[model samples]
Target: MLTEVKERLHSLGISVSSEPSNVDEVIIKFSIEKVTNHIKNQTNLSEIPTGLKEIAIDMVVGEYLFSKKSMGLLNIDSLDFGLIEKQVQDGDTNVTFAVEASSTPEAQFNAFIQYLRHDEVDFIRYRVLIW
Candidate 1:
């Protein structure tokens, strides 16, 4: 999952670097200046795939960054648009996406995968197709 995110972000021209400098202590780091800038620039996260407006709200993104229990985002109930629910069970966080009726599945999935590719949601797995 992390690998896919890394690839996606990289392909999108977003810089994501990692460090596993030590053999005994392994710590992977995903650094992105654009993300910070996006937040600092006060860019609104829209619900549309690949659209700035689709990105989660700044506050929510910050909360996810602070939330340590993120498991994955989306599920069978995640097919819909407009309403994306967050759940944490047994210290695991999962994101359930509910796209609006107007949103296309591809657009939703693209936006979602991009978000999951971000440094915040570490582990992600989804089967239900949005498109």
Candidate 2:
């Protein structure tokens, strides 16, 4: 399951990584504009996707974290949504998150973190593609 999520993320140009530790850290980051451009380049529509551009970042990220938890992906007790980080660089919006309070084993927790950290962001593409 983790491997499949990683493959899907790679297909969508998101990257996931972490440092090995007692409390492992998983970093998920992606470019919002890159995704927008990817959609633009793939489709014939000339209008920008307002849904994507106006998306509520917190809502999306929170729901995504909960969805993965409900799917048995991890034993995340709570997500530090308040501490989530976002930035803009080179005309692209980048969002990043750090995994915390997961009860799964360190390695397993890291894998689960990697899974959602990537899958949830890439899921945005599907949302826009089908919109």
Clashing pairs in 2: none
Which digits, one per residue and each the tens of the lDDT, describe model 1 over residues 61-104? 32332222243422313345435443334556555445365556
Candidate 1 regions off by >4 Å? 21-131
Candidate 1 lDDT score at position 36 = 35
lDDT of 1 at 121: 33
The RMSD of every model to the true structure, in order and in angstroms, is: 17.1, 14.1
The number of clashing residue pairs in each candidate reads 19, 0
Q: After superposition, how far is residue 10 of candidate 1 from its true place, in Å?
A: 0.5
What's the CA error at residue 59 for candidate 1, in Å?
15
Please write out the lDDT profile of model 2 over residues 22-68, one tens digit for every residue: 11122112233333454455443454455543332322233334444
Name the lDDT of candidate 2: 0.40
